[model samples]
Target: MPQIAIGMPVFNNQETLARSIDSVLQQTYGDFVLIISDDGSTDGTWAICEYYARVDSRVLIFRQEANLRYMNFKFVLDQSQTEFFCWLAGDDYYSCFFLEKCISVLNHDASVVCSVPKCQFTAPAGNLSLAEGTFPIVQDEIDMRVTQYLYCPSDNTRMYGLFRSEVLRDSFPPRGFHAYDWALSAQTLCFGKHQEIDEVLIYREKTKRALYTGAVLRDERGLLKQLFPVFRMSVWLLRQKKFPRRRGVVRALIWLNLVKHMEYVSNVHPDFYERSRFFYTYLKKRL
Candidate 1:
């Protein structure tokens, strides 16, 4: 099996799919398999993917019968048998050395379950800017990692990091409309350590994307469930026996993060704040 398995899930990303695939094919570390899952794109994404697959033996492609979005991510994960795995968004691309450096970090440290690099965001207006790095995860404590992940103001760049495949298998699956990465981050911390490399290795396209739409968001119950996924996540974690020995500490941390998450979301997405606040109130009553 290849040393690393990269999962690229595409859904109507025709404009940038080729560039994203090219970035992976150009990785300095050559001993890796790129699995591109076209999430039922009606556009020319599959055609572009097919071209790359034909030319490069390292590239394999699949197409879902329907658009799965977050669920498509799980398809690639199920196919990987390598030591390390990562999910690359359809529109994002990585630097040439991203794989080489991340693989080296995992090989050198048995305790480290993930290696994340800094992120750079690119906009259609030709503007570029840096995002968060591994600095937020500088501390070694697993509990600290979980709390900081909840409180820290950072994108989900770490979720795209090279991870030990076994830990990925053990962690919780993606859930809810948003912040699935945040939920998974908690699970990863419970399993092992995560190291962040200072260099910016991934470029995220600043696209206004919504993971949920249509009938799902139209229903009040569905919207509420999607808005307050942390509650489901917390209950699941407890059932899985993932909380640390000091259960009270874990509960307190969750409450603290819940409040901070509310504040953070309100500031970042003001329009969604009132709805989130309503769901949070509903969450409190449910708890």
Candidate 2:
């Protein structure tokens, strides 16, 4: 079995840190190291991490003096030394065989750079529930799925995935991107292929503050800015003629952004509509 490195960035997640750590420690695949980056957490998160590190040599803990977002996550990932890597959020837990199954796919296919597994979402106050039936089983599938989701606004299927360490290291998430996972997934698809496993290996915690949640939609301007990269990437992919399975979806994505830009201007920034007209025009031409 190849060695795996799991990078986890933690903030003030005292309520779920212990459970997340325990799930990693209990993984059936034992040849793995856990790198925990505490981004200046104010709660008892650090203390809990320290306790686990003291007992388990596999757990390596680091502390960031300030609260950095996904950029800090990239920093910690850079310090890992393993053939495979995956991130587990401070508030999420993984199945004992999560790493094993993902690694198996990578080991089987040299061209595949990542493996995305099915996930279960759970609210802090409620029981864990199945969020979706399955995610894309390959990179082309992810591209198509992402495009459809963008246009129709449905629950996504490609969120929880394990990536090749080198691929992730080469194309780190851009700072200020809404979520590292989105940028990382885009990069992984561009550089290499991906395998989709149907097993629900990750249990995602749906808290108000969780970065992946749709809460950013409340900030219309922020949401539009964040989505710009996804649109940009889609345009690039279309030019490259990659993921032909996703061509239709990509076209829809472009139009979706155009619609969103119009809505934003009509509702919030009517004054800037003239300047933003270029964005809408560009998207319309592509669509």
Of the candidates shown, which would achieve the greatest TM-score relative to the real structure?
Answer: 1
Q: How does each model score on TM-score? A: 0.82, 0.74
Q: Candidate 2 — worst ten consecutive residues by lDDT sum?
A: 211-220
What's the TM for model 1? 0.82
Model 1 weakest lDDT span, ten residues long: 211-220
Model 2 earns a TM-score of 0.74
Which residue pairs in model 2 clash with each other?
Answer: 137-196
> Cα miss at 2, model 2 (Å)?
6.9
Segments in model 2 whose C-alpha atoms lie over 4 Å from true places: 132-134, 137-159, 207-253, 259-287
Show model 1 residue runs off by greater than 4 Å.
Answer: 133-140, 174-177, 207-229, 245-287
Q: Model 2, range 1-287, lDDT digits (tens) per residue?
A: 33888889999989999999999999888998999999999889999999999999999999998777666678668879888888888998999899889888889988788787878888858877775523443434656544544454323335456778888876664454433354445545655665678778888875443333343343224545644424544444444433444567657756765665575454555778777788777767867
Instruction: Give lDDT tens digits, candidate 1, residues 1-287.
Output: 79999999899999998889999999999999999999889989999999999999999999899767776887888888998999999899999999999999989988888898888889888999887635446456666666666555356678899999989878846454344555676678777788888899999986444432322243225534534435555555555556453544465446644664565456546888886688877764543
Model 2, global lDDT: 0.69
Model 1 Cα RMSD, 1 decimal: 4.7
Candidate 2 residue 38 C-alpha distance from true site, Å: 0.7
Q: lDDT scores for all predictions?
A: 0.75, 0.69
